[model samples]
Target: MISHRAPDSLSTWRAAILIAVIALLVSCGKPPPKEISTLDKIRTTGVITLGIRETSVPFSYLDDAQQQAGYAWEIANRVATAVKRDLKLDTLAIHTFVVTPQTRIPLVANQTVDLECSSTTHDRERERQVGFSSSFYLTGPRMLVRRDSPVRDWSDLRGKRAVVSSGTTAELALRKLDRERGLDIEIMLAKDIGENFMTVETGRAAASVQDDVILYSNIARARDPSAWQVVGAPLMREAYACMLRKGDVPFKRLVDATIAEMARSGELMQLYTKYFASSLAVKGGVRIDQPLSDDMRELLRQPNDRID
Candidate 1:
């Protein structure tokens, strides 16, 4: 005959304590999960986040389908492929986050976006906050005005309301010019390229100061392309490159390698022609019609991260 009884409270508590101790011992025996680097995080999660622009036409923007599509968008995809290959990923998911000029750097700095390939300029000031891949495009600030507008150059902007995208190099350049030349220009700040152009279109501002390529692309996509024109010599040349988190050497190496490969194989030129020289299939067959420049050819020949 066998008799069964519940264990005493003290005995049961002891048993629970023993189990807790065993768990602690086992946990201590194993090393803590390795800290996740950007690459490692992407590898483990199978997703890479890309920072893109919504209205930076010909560089990064939305198509008629509202999907991200542009020259920089294509290059970002190539880098994604390289990341996938490097990680030996069977399938890597791409997640895009729309970024404005004001938020692009902060998002990248925080690693919320793994790569930003848009119209961002690479300069010493920005370099302190993020790492830039090889320079992919060269452009400079110019004025966009109505075809009949008298603003033929920067000097004409005096005492006029000129608009620029907030948090862009163009803004800084314009402000500096306003001060040095004493143009007394009333500068209006817009959130993005589209808004900047709209300020001029609506007659709220006399001119929109932006990168020359962007101005050209905007005119091409305008309702009446002939109504707008890009004027004035380029303010100062700027280089556009892919942005990653600061100190992300491995990822930067991969991005730089992919861009360099594209340059050497003439793929970059082909992409340039597709976006700048040819009429886009979207947005009613808009064509930028801007030809490649000597600086761009040189950059293609020797891809680099030189800041201007």
Candidate 2:
């Protein structure tokens, strides 16, 4: 065998060969990159996957039959209708998935669902992860306490246990109050809003703070609706909107436009009245009434998505 030395371009030739191999491997193993726009995905699949809450009460919840329906989901369905019209699809089927507070953000960020029709709040921090349509409902953080509980306001919260959902604006707001007011309030974490209220029900916590709208939902679902009282000054204003994937300006525009059209034509208010302002039958034939607040109508008058 003849002894051989590497050529001057040997390293460059190896790099080029490696690149070629990588390109070939990528071409073989990887499918074309998925289309980014949610609208595009809807167009391609002829279906829209909607993320609805499994236990969000009046916003979105699982019925006895495991079907999802609520004020928020009704709004989402209207938007889906607009989407179907926009795409001019002969038939666009809607698929549903359950998203809890923990999974909601990631599901939207990963585009697992085209839109999250759950009771999701629009805020600055969350805006970094996902997009929101125009405001659909407006609510504020409030505390729910036992009818006999002495906790009338935040001052009474001093040294008392308070329960809030693990990932919610109420949790953040309560924590902030504890820090600034030094109320020494014992913050108890619950898995979801229902459990947050249940902490008070089971006497594990003295108070459950969440959106007033949801508090009413819980009360309506409670075994004894009159046993719990939602009281206290509002903690923070929250705007609930349908969560979408971020950076899709076109889709965002369409969603916002759909909401605006609904507002302009007063159809959103009509749905709100139909669903919330009257006693509607929920799961198990439970009749719950959550009347729309004046602030909710004000939110409709001028839809806003800003967190502050």
Candidate 3:
């Protein structure tokens, strides 16, 4: 039997205050939810984004069918597969975003894109904004000129008009050389590799300065391959590596391990042969026709992320 009493108002108010204080203590004792990381976000969403170049040829490009097809494109897919396996996802979706030289860094830095494995050169300056995976390929700036042109080397470009893709290491190197040697070269900037090549093809510029491999690829796809020539030795060797967001230790480790595994297992060499040796399936079966260089072979033998 319960007793009903309206005479204990003071005691009832004290009991209510005590209950409120206990509730507050319990709420304060529990920990907050953990903040999500890049991998965590990817695991939750089951999607990975890849940044690709549309006209970088064997590195990353759109094929005749408009599908992303290239050596780096294949490597990016492999990394995506690793992510799915690491996250234990039943199915992981791949989303591609086209990135130019100008936009790739910002996209990765701001987390708009997960990673980029194209014809990007990894250098100390870029390391300030983003991280890089193991070096996958190596090449340097060279000149692509008409077959009959008198320009045989960088020295020959003095007082001539030259075209280079905007925001590329080639542009930076060319400008530095111009100032140092007083070449007085009229520099022309193009938005993409296609435009750079076209500028030279249309006689608007005497030469197109770019990576040696890219010049070879352009000639391979040309109507008359013999009409052009890649001249001069490499100006300065540059390493090509996959780019990711800065300070992402786990993701960087995963990417570095993936690249090292490919190098150790000779899969990277096979990929090299597939794109550089054999005829490609793009643009009606074009071939880059470039032999593997000693530097590239060394890079495969020992995968590293050293940038100079």
Alpha-carbon lDDT, every model: 0.89, 0.83, 0.89
Query: How many Å off is the CA of 42 in candidate 2?
Result: 1.8
Looking at model 3, the pairs that clash are none
Cα lDDT tens digits for candidate 2, 1-308: 74477465689899999999999998699565444799899999999999987667667876677677787888888889989999999999999888877788998888788898667888898888788888888888899898999999999999999998887788899999899999999999999766787788999999898888878878878999899888998898888898998878788888888888888889888878766766555656554465557777787877767666
lDDT of 1 at 47: 98
Comparing 1 and 2 on lDDT, the stronger one: 1
- TM-scores of all models? 0.81, 0.83, 0.83
Residue 60 lDDT in model 2? 85
> After TM-score superposition, what is the CA distance of residue 263 in candidate 3 from its true location, in Å?
0.8
Model 1: residues with Cα > 4 Å off, grouped in runs: 1-36
Tens digit of lDDT per residue, candidate 3, span 3-100? 67666888899999999999999868966634326687798888899999887889998888888888888888889988888988999999999998
Better of 2 and 3 by lDDT: 3
